[model samples]
Target: MSGQRRTATRSEHALEDLDGAALSYAARFAEQSEGRRRDHLRDELVQLALPFAGRLARRYRGRGEPLEDLEQVARLGLVKAVDRYDPERGSFTAYAAVTITGEIKRHFRDRTWGVHVPRRLQDLTIEVSQATAVLTSELSRSPTVAELAARLETSEEDILAALESAAGYTPASLNGPVGDDGPAELGDMFGALDADLESVDDRLTVSGLLYRLPARERRILAMRFYGNYTQSDIAAEFGISQMHVSRLLSRTLTWLRQAMLTDTPPRWESTGAPPEPPDAVTVSVDRADGRVQVGIRGELDRSAAERVRCALVDVVCAAGTDEVLVDLDGVGFIDAAGIAALLASHEAARRAAVRLRIADPQPYVRRSLIVAGLAPLFT
Candidate 1:
């Protein structure tokens, strides 16, 4: 369920075909009872399912795990599914999917942790998860730090620190891929070695996506990453708060992720004559820490607003990114179209059940957001 944000609604789309075919083969093998026949069937099923395993492994690429490792974990899950699969229970595709997906998630919870952590931390996590879920069910919507504090009847400062620390302790963000093609699939997380795209070319693709950012973000990203400066150092260079720099770094990372890993696909529908999610705008990406921050700074005149709105919608709507920050800090002015774009982004974030934070509001940005009654939503 980590990657799967949207639940299966229409069964019409059907489970994967190869999985079904594999199940059919297994059934035929069972009928034959010949040793050779069963061996051939099992081998054939493995071959058929190899692609799905790769796809699943791709889903976990940037979550701080190696592709080879994730593939093995997913393969184990697939193999287990093959062993336990009962055609009577459900479609082989769906059943096997559950196993592989679970294995992928378990890897995040168990092995994905790169550093050793205290068992007490795991205990605390379990406690927090249960408490948060119960409180959320009662209160409606994800509980804020303050609301959770009240529920725990503890101090707000403690709650805030706990949340931050909770975030820091994870090996990889467990919320799933930053991008989603459909149902939090593997395609969203990993940039592919296409039929072409030699290894070096992939690096260029990522760099190309980075070039699309506004000059400030691009510079900040380069200095922070290449120069290896802390956000505080970057803040000093730019005369802004470390927090602001941190937020910008996050937004820039998401933009790059959208561009590199996810290829900035056309998730949003343009309202008018605006261009699609070209390299210039609407980069779809998954981040290293698993959270993504995006800044949409271009002029959202009426003609371009609709398309940009759709792109924002895609981010908010997708069951992708555990947390999303959409910064309006760079906008010099705001208009009705711009206001609409922000609202659309906010709604999509909520729908996806992600923590959406909007930071560093310019005067016009604040005014536009307030007029649209989005202050509570963003603040």
Candidate 2:
């Protein structure tokens, strides 16, 4: 995207003035019986059109089409525009711009913009469908962005962003509504009932819930989740810093926890979605339809130990659960309490008959467990 942006930017430089009188004189001579001047003028015009072709290509960035292909399509338009143009028509530049611009937009509408998506990103379309299925089953209500993120074991932001990316090539169109013969979308039957996720209370609860968070937090959630922005992109949008975005997002989580608790009650309480911990304890849990992965990063201070405990408990007890994977892949430090938390969670899983798996344990977490005299049990 950056490269495309740079290529487009190159077009905005100060205008290159062609000596029109000289060009027209040569063109007139070329127009006389079969001659070299017409071909030369046309070739020069094609070269001039190349930069516009590049700029138009960049505007549709992120639609999953290759830039080079779009440029070729645009150049095709430029060629057509150049062919129909007469030097006597206003400025040759203005005449060329109109026909070419229209062609570029039409080209995208037909070949790329909302039609093309790469294989990897196309797979995400399936992931979103599966996620929506899971969330609809669990949440009884339409899932919020935060809830969807929690279920997928990704940040709520990532799930929403993926949905937006998928929207561009949605195998359907938003500009057109469903058939007029049927009732409005929600009013239509979904398995004799309405499966439409947004039809739930018209998303009233989630929107109301968002109003409770701080404005900055609300903006972060909007940018990250809805607009498909990375943290860096969000940082750039607000004209602040990435660290600033990091800090703000941390605080946003704390506020979300508090607000949800105030509005709904215990449903989300005891959730792994606790207050954001310091860099001292970094935990990531990726919950998907078929499996649950729990990853812990950084040192777990004694105070931060419960964060890990509650997280393990949440997934281990989750319904339709498969396996609980403890990824100590990023753990470089640990304390006695952290070790105890793992052991307790493991035992709890045993009682429930939940499959508990620990993967590629990091050296530090391994050393801590061994020194604690618990290594023999797992081995």
Candidate 3:
């Protein structure tokens, strides 16, 4: 015990010697003129105080920041103290120790948190941590939130919030391993892809396609699929035979499938109704200037599309006709079927080495062609 006391006494004497030397240097440094001599004095002062700054930095070790980084901060603070020290005010040793410790604390307050935290919460977090350590030592166990709150003289809610905010100081990485024995990571524990999300686009597409169908057919589809009605029930509701309902369902589904596959959908037609008479659509063909002009009148819908297609194909396939112009000045409306008919005629003309063009389409017809991506054919 006597030897230990002697060692501590010698250590205190050494510290006193260091403090006296540092004070004398600081006083001389402040008195000296601004030159190499003064700079040399200031540098010597910093060198003399380095071990003290290093000891202060060590107090902050195991607090998430690297020891090297803390030491760097402390050295910076020591330099600042040397440059701004006033020998008349107080001891240089006391001023530098405060400056260096404050610098280290400020580094933790501002730079260590992984996420932005309110200054109040940050200070509270440190208080809570210190309180936890003290309470754990006093009670020999972790303290409850109420005990912490009483010790900190704050509400339990504030203590809880501080504890939660403390987690933001060092967030766990998602890429980190989940367990000690396996390759699985923390990210792998998250929820998997939702199967229903994959069908969102298809559902939207089908909704638009369903709107394009005739009202009766739309109702039939809704009853069968949405209402969960059987084919016989649908046939009974519509006053049609079960076989007819079956055939209509088959054809409608086939058309919907084909429509969904293509950028442009097919036009809907009623199989129960009789075909439109040939006189409903008029096709007039005239040969002029080595080109056949085929003038079509009336609505170029599904009813008239086939007839128009056949007439245009015949004119295009004629050996003498090098070019054919299909005029649509009188056609008030056109549908997907009409566009399909025009496409078929264009294909036939291509095979026959004849140039087919569209001319004099009305405003509505022109817009329809543009929408169907056939405006270039008219130009």
Candidate 4:
């Protein structure tokens, strides 16, 4: 007990020394009149009082607000306190603590809540929180709602309502882990009736059909639909006849139709409009001297392939020229899908009986085309 008392005395002496240092800094800060000296003094005082602010901020940790963010808020409060503090009014520690707590409370009130809640409930929640902390200290246990109501001089119903609304302060993720060493999520505990299961059934049928296809065949489809590869490009990649690629694609598409017919695909409802396609490629057409020039920009990968293919086809088909020139000068990247898109465009140009020339491709793009055995076509 004597050793405990000695330790307590040392702690008290240490606190007193801290208070003396803070007070000295604050006096120096307040004495300077709007100069670098004043700024320097203010910095010194703020740095001195930062630990106090940090301690105040730590009170609200693990409530979803990151400790770092809370500390930032507290530091701002300390700066305000240092600027507004009057040594004549009160001790800097007490003033700074109040200011920092107010900042943290304001942070919750203004920013932390995920959903809208009433102003009265918000104020009461903060009040209840403060009362709970104080009561927990005084009683050595969490206070009951009745006890909380008594402390705050409010009804038990109001205390309960505030407690309920406390959930709005930090809305938890359904994906968050809860029980220790458990594989289940919060989402797993709940289920809602989905009226759209019929649509899901149709999608699953089509998805299963596609997934069941051979990897190479699926890749070809991806090149055609997702990668925007022409049948000719796909054929060249596989060292097969273009007619074979065309037949394979047609068979796959027919399978999709058969599955959809069996499943009775649902008509899209008007509750929401279809999403707009993303702008992954840009195309500009210039016609001059019995030739049409098409300028393409952006990465020509799987994502952009379909758009690029369509743009090339439309431009080439519409151009009443002996030669259609595709200028890929602005294109930065190209992939297998992009090569397929170009080959598809070439096929479309052939059907229209027009010459399609790939002109001024970037060095890497030209290298890719050459490697893909389409160098002669481009020249």
Candidate 5:
């Protein structure tokens, strides 16, 4: 044992001597003029100090960084020390050791964290880690938050925050396996698909389209879908037949489906037309000088809206017609369904590059259009 101690002492002395010689050489190299000779001497100095830098880098091993990368950082620091060293200020050996160690530490602090943490918290994390290790060894167990805070001379909140920040240093990969035996990933545990989320878009779309329907039809839809009422129940509440309720529901649903699928919503048709015959609405078309005049005569209610819209669309689609005038003077009354049909025909005319204008509308029909916000389009 005595012989081994002596041998170790000799090895230490030999290293000390080598370090002294290298420092002396570095000082000489710094004094040389900037030329090939100086460059050669600088290279020699770097080669001589490489082993010392490697030793400093080895002190940081098993710290998540690769040994080769740490050594590279240390060697870079050594080169900087050699270039910036002023021999008169201090000893090169001590200065180079500090510079290299600091470079290695900075590499870990700046680059190794998976998430950005404040500098203060990062330092606190290190101090807390060292304190926990020491306390665990002394007490033979993990230290509590209060114990850690006391040892670090900080509040328990700060200690807890530091503990949380430490996790940012090396976060687990989301793609990593959950366990040794499990095939699932860490991300798989986060959440599953929400069945209702798939219908969220449909719900939003239908909510907007529902207002376009007549109030009775809208009520019927709400009663059936939202209130979960049977057709017979809705029929009894509305004082209508079950067949009428079913027809209204079917028509409302079909219009909503078409509205959701298309940029232009289809015109609405009412199921409760008061036994009025189809001849109640009449349409006449006359063309002259590249213009077509369409005359509509009737109440222009839901029962007549679809017929008037179809006739106007046919007139607009006809070739060689640049302008269409819809005469609603003979119409005595109009409703939401009638307004929707006119708007639909206007949209069709606009797409077909034909100019369509409303020539005349009765006072009631004009007021209805104004209330529906369609008067501007007609004007």
Candidate 6:
């Protein structure tokens, strides 16, 4: 009894503190004009009432409503209550509680239903539910519709309608477990896949948008957007700074969004002349799904090393591929110059946060990399 009294006293003290804070904030709000100070006081006022609103929200939880979402709705309600509250009307705590509870109830009435139904049935469904649970506990079994009606002091017809409307509270999952004793799922009863796959249009749209970007840009987008990599993570991969990644991402996405709005080719693609082919090495860049494949077919010696290095670095940065597979199967040799190119590309990929790999290296090429002690780097 002593412990309970102490807890109650502590709660009372906390409430008093909150009330004092709120009144102070209100006084400050009235004194200030439209400025940062007034906004700050208003925010502090809302913060003070959030705890009370949270308690009110928890009362309406667990009927398939997410508590976090309810709390957010309740917080919004508290803000409204704090805005409209008058000290002359009643205590701020009582007024805020009523406002917050109304918001939560409004959430259930307007948004919680998975399927549309009559508003009267929707409200009665909640009443019927509460009555059913109480009667079930008292009788030690599920209550009949007639018993629920009697308990709720409603007609049997109204009880049946509300019970039927209860299905709108939660939509049944197609993949949910089915049958009392079997392992079958609800989806197992369905037929074959839909002939028109839903992802086709999305895939085509994304593919079209991605194709407009250079290989390095594509790889960056893939890493940042598709891979959910942070700017710092991408910077570490590409050996670039986080600021550079941020600018690159911002500019690229802005361009894409603008192009989408205008329904025209982006400025990069609008240039009259096509990009000149790399002179020293033959470079072919291809993107499928989210992967960028760069095929290099030629002797990777000093004469072609710089070209190869530049081509590779460009591809790694621009490809927008989750994983870059460099097909080195056609390469006949690799000297120090070629090794330098490989190392440079590898380091660049590391900084950009791109996945760079040497795919199907020929035996001679492998020996050259291994001999130069560079084999471990290209995986």
Q: Model 4 — which ten-residue stretch has the worst lDDT? A: 267-276
Worst 10 residues of 3 by lDDT: 270-279
Question: Comparing 4 and 6 by lDDT, which wins?
Answer: 4
Ranking by TM-score: 5, 3, 6, 4, 1, 2
Question: So what's the TM-score on candidate 6?
Answer: 0.42
In model 4, the Cα lDDT at residue 257 comes to 77
TM-score, model 1 to reference: 0.32
**C-alpha lDDT of residue 177 in model 3:** 97
The residue-by-residue lDDT of candidate 1 on 1-379, one tens digit each, is: 7335343422222234665676687679779876887878777787778777778789779867788989999999988988787777878878778899999887776764555545545445555667899987987888887777777777777666555546655545445664655457444565765765466777756654543445577689889879999888899999999998887777666656665667333232222354333223333434447767667654454656787778767766663667777766655445688677777777777767877777777655676678888787564
TM-score of each: 0.32, 0.27, 0.53, 0.36, 0.53, 0.42
Give the CA lDDT, 0 to 100, for residue 241 in model 1.
Answer: 92
Misplaced by over 4 Å in model 3 are: 1-14, 17-19, 131-161, 190-197, 214-258, 269-379
lDDT (Cα) of model 2: 0.66
* Clash list (residue pairs), candidate 3: none
lDDT of 3 by residue, 276-298 (tens): 33237799998778778889976
Model 1 whole-model lDDT (C-alpha atoms): 0.68
Winner by lDDT: 3
Candidate 4: tens digits of C-alpha lDDT, residues 41-129: 77877776676678889999988789999999999999998888877787878888888899888888888887788989999988999
* CA lDDT of each prediction against the hidden true structure: 0.68, 0.66, 0.84, 0.80, 0.82, 0.79
Q: Residue-wise lDDT of candidate 2 within 1-379, one digit each (tens)?
A: 9999886565444134433633554466456665676677667767755775667667865766777777777788778876776665567567656776777666555555465655545555557768788888887767777776776677766676677776676455434446786445533323464477656754644555553343457779988889989999998888988998887777666656565556442222222345333335666878777788888875564666888888888778872475777887666556688888888888878877887877766555677688877674442
Candidate 6 lDDT score at position 316 = 86
Residue 310 lDDT in candidate 3: 89
